[model samples]
Target: MTKSVLVIGGSGGIGSALAQHYAATASVVTVISRQKAPTQNSWHWFEDTLQSPAHSAQCVQLALEQRPEVIFICNGVLHDAAAMPEKTIRQLDTAILMQRLHANVAVPAQYLQLLFSYITKTAGVKVVVLSAKVGSITDNALGGWYSYRMSKAALNMLVKNISIEVRRLNPSAVVVSVHPGTTNTAMSEPFQTNLPPGQLQSAANTAERLAQVVAAVQPEQSGKLLNWDAKALPF
Candidate 1:
């Protein structure tokens, strides 16, 4: 049984569900998010915008002090009131692209960097970053959603790089990117209309599947991108 877990972006639909799922079994559940997470007596909440290096470092330091065995980085942004994903080259905006990059890639990269030493030190540690299959360069047949796609692709590369580096220091560590599938979350709300019926999953269901994936992933699968069912996908 896992003793401790950390869920970044824990206020979001899937993140919150994952935290709650682990909280039932794990003794220590630490969550860091921009907004306050739902009240749970067993959980530790840290409000962090992830905008300042000093602030992020402080939160990560405190959280990692617990030596969480499982870590989930679920920070991502597909759209906002200011802009939706670009459907074509004509709709692409520099500001929007940068926003997506900062949220999807930079923020997670910062946390991974902060958590590096702790991850290497902990035995059998599992680090799962929520990535989208759309990020796969080899799987891009139907192209669009420029900013979101580009940012996720960059995030996947970051995960791959970190996995390789971490493996050298700690062979027991498992760090991989996972595509959580189309879950019923605010991030996927706008696009759910076209999804084939059963493709949309509840937050709880997604969390359960993600937890299973985390449990089953081995050190050999560290650098690959995995689907919801733990199948390896092309990078």
Candidate 2:
């Protein structure tokens, strides 16, 4: 059967790559983004943002119509034009922290809340939220980027909490947090220096790896934080 896939941040690097990859097998690939997709004809595009409650509602409405088998909440912001990650405690600012929280934590949680209703018990569904290894509280050996780390940690918690409820409602549905590793995207462009050789992967490569991870997930594995290689990350 042809799959129905939904990508929330379809205009971004990994999101676009996943949309392209899934389009080959999906009967209809729907992308919800604030910007226009480069390859407009490859998938159905819905111009929207999850910045506000109204937009979130619209997202749920659109997604309910699609009833996606695989949904990827790929939206995230790291060092955007308005703010960059704090290098030290003294550099931390409330405004920047709030922006990061809104983008990284609140927005994605809201999307998941609204979209969960459409996932039926009979249909096997997977929801993958792009998270970071830094989000792991137990893996915080190199502590920096306070706001970004906090936001991702909160997002991970949200995923964990949502997974419990989702499993109760739809046993076949799985919600997971994924760390895509360091990819060659605009988001990681400013911090690509001093990385080990072959550490940075292309968006297409990361997308393929992510797809494999998603495919390998089972309902019993819901709520776990998975690395690109499909190993469980420490909470």
lDDT of each: 0.91, 0.86
Put down candidate 1 lDDT per residue, 102-170, tens digits, no spaces. 999999999999999988888899999999999999999999999999999999999999999999999
lDDT of 2: 0.86
Model 2, range 1-235, lDDT digits (tens) per residue?
4378889888899998888888876557888888955653867777775457787688668755776778899888889777778879999999999989988998898788778677545468889999999999999998889999999999999999999998888898889999999999999999999999999999989988998998889989899999999999999
Best by TM-score: 1
By summed lDDT, which 10 consecutive residues of candidate 1 come out lowest?
36-45
Candidate 2, number of clashes:
0
TM-score computed on alpha carbons, candidate 1: 0.97
Give per-residue lDDT, candidate 1, residue 221. 97
Clashing pairs in 1: none
